[model samples]
Target: MPGRDETDILHSWHRNADAWTRAVREELIESRRLITDQAIVDAVLDNRPRSVLDVGCGEGWLVRALAAHGIQAIGVDAVPALIEHAREGGGSFQVAAYDDLIAGRFSQRVEAVVCNFSLLGEASVERLLAALPSLLEADGRLIVQTVHPLIACGEHAYVDGWRMEAWTGFGAAFPAPAPWYFRTLASWIGLFATSGWQLCELREPLHPQTGRPASVIFVARR
Candidate 1:
């Protein structure tokens, strides 16, 4: 089976823009605001990072939130339509693939890189992680959140497909035909450590309603 391309996912998202946006706002963004925003907000609170780069900023929801907190934020997306939708919300949005990000996009290194539920679909985690240092300031931070590797690989009857679950004895199998890389908590920290990042914090949010773990959140300083 072929790995899913980020572009293909973007195309699909664009095709269902209305429904996608609503789902994002309801299930992912608005509903999980406390879990998502609070974790990121706390990590950046002490540093007061100014300039921000939002990788895979779909629809600019998080970008706008960052701007509201007084951070100068610019969001980049692979989909032009999503970027356009994001731009309409009062922040700068650029149409660029994660693999294509270079120094030219920003005048200087940004103080923080916020990648919320993005980047997992990328074909190369090493290449994706490697790009962080160049995009980050010396004391900058990288805040990332995604479906927990363990849960992401497992079969979830609720979703009508496999979710994060155990496979190969230890690691996780990719949930779909996409390049969904799932790592255990240790593996996750290890990957960041190899790239010269010091782990700052790890938060696993409990669902507001069920109190079950929902997502894995990490804060790393470079």
Candidate 2:
């Protein structure tokens, strides 16, 4: 079992798949920033990957999108409801912890593994990054987009008092006592290096409307 904090946060966020989907859908619809993700996907999938596994694939949007383009896609999520939601959309769905996902029943010859805004959720960054290579093909790519540590850290505004924000558990509400690990750009690059991945591209996002920089984008190769 993961723990109270991980379980609580997962439960809260995934308790209602529709709500999560709607929130993300609305964010994308209003911002018109899918172009960046699209470009990253296109660049990584230049050779038309035969198998692509979307780690932490929430709600199946990316999996469905990739399948539509004749690529075999599988989405794995930690939350059961999210996995069911992904399965209902007609793609392979696995409800397993990130560490357990690799040994599951799936083709091991994955050409690319996509992690969109997922890996930084209070997990072991080094161990997780290290395991990604075995899940990919020889020339596979690891396309990752995460909340930049600086901006994400900024989200922890000390309201009421100088309190530290933490993940009390999965599906749990915020403001609970938990520890959060925020990484700098240099630290993230170094993490990949230690994890045996070579940096191929770094695509930091600019504020969609204002063109101000926001999050960091990373594309690594095994």
Best by TM-score: 1
Model 2 bad stretches (over 4 Å): 1-11, 16-18, 25-40, 102-107, 155-180
Error of 2 at 201 (Å): 0.8
Cα lDDT of model 2 overall? 0.66
How much does each candidate deviate from the true structure in C-alpha RMSD?
6.6, 5.6
* lDDT per residue as tens, model 1, 42-101: 555556889888888878888787778898988887777778777776788888776677
Cα lDDT computed for each candidate against the true fold: 0.67, 0.66
Candidate 2 C-alpha lDDT tens digits along 97-174 = 666754544446699888876664445546678878888888988988775666555655422112234432223233
Question: Where does model 1 exceed 4 Å of error?
Answer: 1-8, 26-34, 102-107, 156-179
